[model samples]
Target chain A: MDSMIQINNLKKTYSNGFNALKGININIEKGKFFGLLGPNGAGKTTTIGILTGLVNLTSGNVLIDGYDVIKDYKITRRMIGLSPQEINLDVFFTIKELLTFQGGYFGLSLSESKKRVEKLLYDLGLEDKVNAKARELSGGMKRRVQIAKALVHDPELIILDEPTAGVDIELRHLLWNSLKEMNIKQNKTLLLTTHYIEEAEALCDEVAIIDDGKIIAQGSPKELIKADGESYINITVNKINENILSDYNIDINENIIKITSKNPEKDIPNIINILSESNIAVRNLNVKTASLEDVFLKLTGKNIIDD
Target chain B: MINTPFLTLIYREVLRFIVLYKQTIMPGIISSGLYLVIFGHALGSRIGSINNIDYIHFIIPGLTMMAVINQSYANSSSSIMQAKYLKFIEDYLVAPVSGFELSMSFIIGAIFRGVINGILIILTCWMLTDFNVHNYSLSLFFLIITSCVFGAIGVIIGIISKSWDQVGVFGTFVFMPLSMLGGVFWSVDMLPKGWQFITILNPLYWMINGLRYSMIGISEIPIMFSIIISIIFAIIFTIIASVMFSRGYRIKS
Candidate 1:
């Protein structure tokens, strides 16, 4: 697979002597929905800023579509659209005007810009708020408009820094469906950074979890969960037989059997069979499979939302 | 070659002032009108002509230049300060616009505002008093150069300013006092020898005198010297603003 974004030894030390990025490397393939998951100060926004030319890099190189971000900024910036984490819209302009201006910035003609703006607004459920100013809309409505602005020019790569942050569930699902459609049907490469682990798991093909300005783990959602995530099987029985379950890793309390297994699906039947053979008389069984959230907690040693 | 993004930036900036014309434009016209009513008419009656021209007519060009300077500076500086504080400047930063293009766009927008306000004040003078522009081209040259000078200064201030108070400091303390002491309402010859020396050192004096010379065909200093000084101010400020913008000084991290 061809890489759309290639970052090598990227480092950023802010003017105030804060180390935002400590030589991180990231490669995102074309047409892939990639996610960067990290805490609030984990350099996610700084990385996005460097890619979009809003922030200068302290050292190292970043390339988009084979063009260096610094050397060929015009070409690189023209190929990517960014929806920043902050609500930074020009409040003076209406939603239609703002999106139209954004398209114009990417070299779209007036008619072409208007057409794309209309289509994006309709798809984002912001058609009614098109004539309204950004300040007039609710927070969720403004988030939709931000997405529409990013998609107006039809850039090849889209960088969304917390696109669904602070939005309601309904709007979040709406944005998710639209983003998935763009990735699947249009073959647009998407780079997303989010605090929501489930969002990353559901939308991203691959995810890199960064902590303290370093990428701690990188893989598909299932791969990370399988490799680092822990699953548990808790079986409640009328009576516990310790010797029959001695062949397995089991923690037994008076009448309950707790088993830790890497493959919960394969181990549950075996455990049940052994209990049946030993006449343990199992009453209830509960299996807990590891998810992306669990994997994140285990890797970072804290919740993604922890400040 | 036409650059659509650059043009769009200029258009957006120009539209910003137009959308807020009540704040950006109305105050200048109203203030200039008051000066004409109270200072030009009532004060002119008490104070006779100073340089073979009527007092009311003598202040016309100075008032017009004042409009150009104030509007030009206000447009660029306020526009940038608003964008900065509101965090909408990221739109321009992320775009394909080069630093030079971004600087020029804001300057061009300032020029439009300066020229528009200058023309409106000139029209206001013609209606209220016997004022006529003696040299149309020279008057226009002064209008444009003065706007360029102040517009560039506005950009510099906007980029370096961290607060709204800092943005207003230049207009209140520097430009306002200088405009008053720049021979706007009186001739430099009326001052004492030492005060005259101090007034000549003021750059605003040259700009106001240059525009006054164009309007009334009279100036205390040579018209060519005033033109050179105005151009020098424009060039220095433009270069500083362009360099600051290109370097992303205080704007990008």
Candidate 2:
């Protein structure tokens, strides 16, 4: 497996003695969208900070394309681009100025920066906003500009920290499509953290579910569901008769009763006969497969606030 | 991606203030001009002939350096504090740019503001009194170097402060009193002998003396010490501010 980033037993203990990352080990392959899933304060930002060389780590190492981040910072930094959670920009600067300046920070000549800025603005649907001040940009455009600024350096690895939060569905799809193109067309390695479970499930080929500074589950979304057999049967009684559920083999689960017996069809007939005799009618029945969100909620036990 | 460089950083800082010209530059100029008008009206006529020069001529250097120092300090302190408050400074942290680059950028921005203020003050004073600034080279040298030095110190203040309130805390508690007592509008020689010695220790006193020497061709303190002290303060403050930045001192939070 060709890993673009390999973090080994990564740990970060803050000055106040908060352990943000605990023995985290993960390998991200090249040209793939790797999702780092966690509830708030589960240390997603901290991990991103460490990988991008912003936060100091107490122990362990991060290797970006086999380049040690600490020992060889220049080369490692050149390989990665970080779109931070905060929209930090010189509000006085125009979008074109910001991108060109960012390009210059990467050592590109004026003409070269100009070329890159033009292409990026056009690609990110920011061509019309090239002259707009950062303060004048809408929230979605600002987020896109942030991404464009990061891409100005043209790094192989791009780390987006919650890029889709507070954005409308149209902009979300726009961002996702651009990110997908970055991965599939340009072969960039993208590490994105998102609040949208659907976004993660639809986009990521692999995910790590972190809770309380530990990885509880890490696998493909489909494989995670398969690994747990996250499927269920639900049967609701029509009438208000508790007796239908009692004196029966059907397992009760809140409003919807359940049964995991070998023969659901055979068991249904018996359940119907017993419910009819007790004056309880069958209202609704279902056999459903679990979604990625169900697996996420079950593993992490925190509602992922899409807002 | 842009490669963060020393020049790029400097350009950004310069652009930062220039684009927001009113907030950074105009107040200093207008304030200095008002002082020139008010003080030139009230005191210039009464305290005549200090070391064979009119009161207004004697005070021009002091008022000019005063504007430079205040503006330089405010620009650096306010900009950094705002960045910190808005949580926007992490952009610099993740970049390959070194701490020295960031510190120098802010300091240079302060210098830019200070120098512009000094020029405005000098121009206004020239129009009001037409004072034949006796030694042009010395006055120019002192103004440039002093503004640069005080501007660097502003970077130190910005690095040390946590909030906008802290700016007032430092400015009112320290800069205001020290500047007033530094003999901007008068001579230390006019004071009692004991107080004169205390004036020698105030760094702003030497700064004013250097400017005085340039404008009126005389100074209470040796012009040599004034020049040397300004350069020394510049080096000390630069070293301190850069060290704070390099260690990631206040930026992490």
Candidate 3:
């Protein structure tokens, strides 16, 4: 597949001498749902800003498709649609008007803009709020409007910066389904920056974990989670004792004991037999695979929401 | 198709203010009417006339220029500042529009508001007084040039401001005082010789004089000089604004 976005050693330093992005490189393939995970101040938005021409690069090159961002901004801008993390719509404008105006910004005529707006409003489940001012809509509806605004021009690549931040679960699922449909039916490339590790695990085919202004790890969610082939076993006994599993890295809390097992299938049975011999009845047990959250924690050593 | 982006941007800007006409357009008309009543009616009889025109008539040109200048500056400056604070400027920043096109759209939008205010004030003046517009074509020419200059100045102000208070400071301190002392209420010849020279140096004074000449065929300076100064100022401010945008000044970083 051809690369949709290519960043060659990108760097960005703010006026206050803070380096937001340090010698970074990334290439997003065409027609892929890519997730960029990072903690606060991890340069995710900074990279998005550069890609959308909202920030000047300190040094390096960014190519969208085959066009350099700085030299061919017109073409690059027309090729990408960004729904920024913040709610930046004109509050006075109605939902339909905002989408129509945004389409016109991309050089669409009024008739063309209206046709696209109608479909976007209907697709995003905002047809009822079409005439309502943006400020009058609920938080979830406003987010849906932002997404509709981004997709109004029908750009080839869509970059969403935390599109689900502060959104309710029911609305989030709706947004996810819409995005999935777009990615599948339209073959559109999407770059999603989200703090919800579970969301990334559920939707992203590939993920990149960025920390301290650098991308520390990048791989498919499952590949990154189980690349070490590590799993864990949790056992519940009728009673808990400290020295019961001293030969392993065991964590005991009350009547439960957790152990890291290289092979859960083989380890669970042997561990159960030992517990049976010790006069402690094994009440329940289960094997748990490493999740994307664990991988993110292992790489960054901090929670995604923490600074 | 060639003018789609440019025209759309201008349309959006124009619609922005038009939708908020209660806040944008009404205030200028009401305020100009008050000035016509207080300054043109209450004080016109006492101040007598200048250049063989009634004091009420003489002040109409000045008041009309004031409306044009203030509205032109306020329209662009407030529009940009609002977009910046609301973070909606990212819409254009990420779009396919060029910096020049963006700047021109705002300038033209300001001109629209400025011209509207000027015309409304003139209509109001005609209702109360018998002030005749001496040269219709020249009056339009100077009105457009003045609006362009002030609108360009507004863009520069909008780019430099980090907060709305800064915009207010420019209006209250810089623009307000300049309009008052720019020979709006008095003639330049009334001042001492040295003071008259200093007064002529003010661009706002040239704008008012140019407008007065267009409306009444009497000016403290040559009409050509006023035209040249207004055009040159507009060009210089436009160039500065375009460069500031291209550099991504405060709006980007």
Candidate of highest TM-score:
1
Per-residue CA lDDT of candidate 1, range B1-253, in tens?
Answer: 6688898898888888899989888888888989989888998989989778889999988888888889999889988898898888888988898888888888889998998888888888888877778999999999999999999999999999999899899899999989999998999988999999999999999999999999899999999999999999999998888888777899999
lDDT of 3 by residue, A54-111 (tens): 9999999999998999999988998899999999988767888888989988878989
Q: Which predicted model would earn the best DockQ?
A: 1
Q: How much does each candidate deviate at the interface, measured as C-alpha RMSD after superposition?
A: 0.8, 2.4, 1.1
Candidate 3 regions with alpha-carbon error over 4 angstroms: A228-230, A237-257, A262-282
- Rank by DockQ (best first): 1, 3, 2
- Say which prediction, candidate 2 or candidate 3, comes out ahead on lDDT: 3
The recovered share of true contacts, given per candidate in order, is 0.83, 0.36, 0.85
User: Each model's TM-score?
Assistant: 0.97, 0.86, 0.94
Docking class of 3: medium
Across residues B59-116, which tens digit of lDDT does each residue of candidate 3 receive?
8889889889988999899888988988998997888877888888899999998888
User: Would you list the rank order by TM-score, best first?
Assistant: 1, 3, 2
Q: Kindly indicate the candidate among 2 and 3 with the higher DockQ.
A: 3
Q: Please write out the lDDT profile of model 2 over residues A1-307, one tens digit for every residue.
A: 6889999998888899899989899899998898988888888898898887678888999999999887776677778888987888766689998788776665566678789999999988889998999889899998898888789878899999988887899999988888888899999999988778788888898888887778888889888876653555577875455554564445666666775543454566777787788877678978666667777887877877732
